[model samples]
Target: MLTNQAIRNVANDLDRRWISDDYFDLIVWYETEVQIHGFQLCYDKPGRERALTWTRERGFLHTAVDSGESKPTANRTPIVVADGTFPAGQVRREFIARSGLLPAEIRELVLARIKDYEDRQSA
Candidate 1:
């Protein structure tokens, strides 16, 4: 769990980020009162990295990471680009399985968000 003070000092908002060796990064934002505002899950870091971003205003967006290596720019920064497909089943299974180390406060919220995204997609 991230401290509220740290989040405020770094972002001027309530945000938490979890980085793991499990090849996924989870970033979450909260509105005042600790209500979840949004979250972005970046997965498969070693191979074909992708991001699943969900926001209260924009809903869900799945994107592939453009590693900025194709053009050979001086500054190699990864950017999110539009992705044609989201392997929902694979991502869901992998996330759930690997998220065991997450803190209890955030684990369930992220899992629920994943489920919500899949539900919306199937609907």
Candidate 2:
């Protein structure tokens, strides 16, 4: 569970978070209600890190992280860059396997969001 105030705090929104061995990080947000409004899941920190972001209004976004290491000499800030495709199958499976520690509702919602993304992709 992540408790960092700077990272977790958002105006008029509630959050649930989980972090595992620096490899996987998940944050789900709700707007003062039971319904989830958005979430951001980041994975594969050791390699080419990527994130799957989903918002109720904006939908899903898959992005690769630029760890600011491309130029060792320059101190650059890490940022998210466009990712070509979302590996929906692998990510959904992985999330199911690792999200056992999260609350059942939160986990289920995340899975449902992933499924929604997959359905959109296949359409």
Candidate 3:
């Protein structure tokens, strides 16, 4: 599974510019592939949190906890997931793409990083 540490590591490795825009989707994919329960991504706005909650409530995967801050939040408090194997990269990429993000390469890269992190953790 994708632990907070692993997710953070992957997020840290990716270009922050790329990650800031779509980290939630990566988190959701990681959580779903790993079959984690009650996972949450802490954000600053209740609206963002609510958005994540909507996704989770729909049984998509994961949730977000908005910190209610005025300023836009950085990638604080990486998402956590119970330990488990994730889906293959192609499958993960497809999943994220379907979620509405563009440029398939971004999701592909994220999935690659996630797999790398998971491998390191297991090793």
Best by lDDT: 2
RMSD of each: 3.9, 3.2, 13.5
Q: How many backbone clashes does candidate 3 have?
A: 4
Residue clash pairs of candidate 1 = none
Q: What does the lDDT read for residue 83 in candidate 1?
A: 91
**lDDT of candidate 1 over 2-120, digit per residue (tens):** 22122333647565554455577777777754677888888888998999988889988999988888664566888999996677778778877876766676778777777887787
lDDT of 2: 0.76
Off by more than 4 A, model 3: 1-101
On a 0 to 1 TM-score scale, where does candidate 3 land against the true structure?
A: 0.28
Sort the predicted structures by TM-score, highest score first. Answer: 2, 1, 3
Q: Ten residues in a row with the worst lDDT in model 1?
A: 1-10
- lDDT by residue (tens digit), candidate 3, 1-123: 112223333552322221223233233333433332222222223233322211334532333443444456654554434333333343345445443543454444544544554455468
Error of 3 at 71 (Å): 16
lDDT score of model 1?
A: 0.75
Candidate 2, residue 3: Cα displacement in angstroms equals: 10
What is the Cα-based TM-score of model 2? 0.78
